[model samples]
Target: MAMAQNFRSAFHGFNREDVVRYLEYLNSKHNSAINQLKSENQTLTDELKALRAQTVSNPAAEAECARLQEENQKLLQQCGDLAGQIAKLQAQMEEAQKNKPLAEEELEAYRRAEQAERAAKERARQIYCQATGALAEATTQVDEAAEDFKLLSQRIATQMTDLQSTIDRSKEALTGAAATLYGVCSADTDSQ
Candidate 1:
């Protein structure tokens, strides 16, 4: 909207005083806006710097990752021990089957051996199940860590983009204000 002017003033389509006053007001407003923009830019820049610094020190995530790795190693070792036990039991059973004994005492011993083999197999199966659960838990922790890192990176990226956009807008606003003030000052000087 244009500023209202009393055109009935002496020899004028619009009041020169009103035009000057409006221009002064505009120049002051632009100056104030420029100062505010500079302040906001500084604040945003500081916040971004702080965020970057925080990204550098994610010690908790690192520690968690290390702990998960250790757990995985332990689970793998347990799985290996269980596999060895299973193999040994299978070998013993096969040997017993090859040496067939007909005596009652010998048959009773064979039955006991079979029972022991079954117990060993069941224990191995239980250990295998435990190892599987541990592995899955480790995998889940790793995935959560990855997701957290990704979210932090995305947050940083978004902040950087916003800061850059504010800077660009401030620059454009300053440029436009400078051009407008220059035009007004030049016109005043020329009219003199």
Candidate 2:
């Protein structure tokens, strides 16, 4: 999402609360995504264990489980990368705030920092969306695989029902976060 560059400039510099709040919001949103991914990973792991416990071994099901696990790992890695980027951005903001300079150079530096933060936020959002899509696809594949096994189908159907609810909640949370961000950005624009 494109945000205006205008920030409410204070006597000494741009409003610290505005910058801090924006960063905090991004951090919260990213953290939520990370937690959701972790929960899903755990669920998949549990399901894999259950599948293995069955006496009747299906090679195709095992292969599908392995693929899902690998995808979960990749998603986790992406989340870790995003988290690292957020921390770096937060550090840069804090450092900029501490070294507040009443000069044109300082204003330029602040602008650069803001731009970097925006880029990071955009990247995080993209990653979250991608991960969500991948998860839905994976779940569908799991459902399809479950159909081949009588016992597995019942278990997966129950799990999918629960997972659907979780996905719904995640989507709601994401929407709320986006709305909060828009409101914050709008307030900043109005303040200017």
Candidate 1's residue-wise lDDT over 1-192, tens digit each?
254443235222334445445545545554565555555555555554555566566767556545555655565555556556555645654544454343345658878999999999999999999999999999999999999999999999999999999999999999999999999999999999
Q: Provide TM-scores for the models.
A: 0.31, 0.45
Residue 34 C-alpha lDDT in model 2 = 83
Which candidate wins on TM-score? 2
- How many residue pairs of model 1 clash at the backbone? 0
Q: Which stretches of candidate 1 lie over 4 Å from their true place?
A: 1-105, 166-192
Q: Taking the tens digit of each residue's C-alpha lDDT, what string does model 2 give over 1-192?
A: 122254577757667666666677677777888888888878888887887787887998889888887987897898788789788878977876776554557778889999999999999999999999999999999887777686777878999999999999999999999999999999999999
Question: Model 2 clash pairs?
Answer: none
Model 1, CA-based lDDT:
0.66
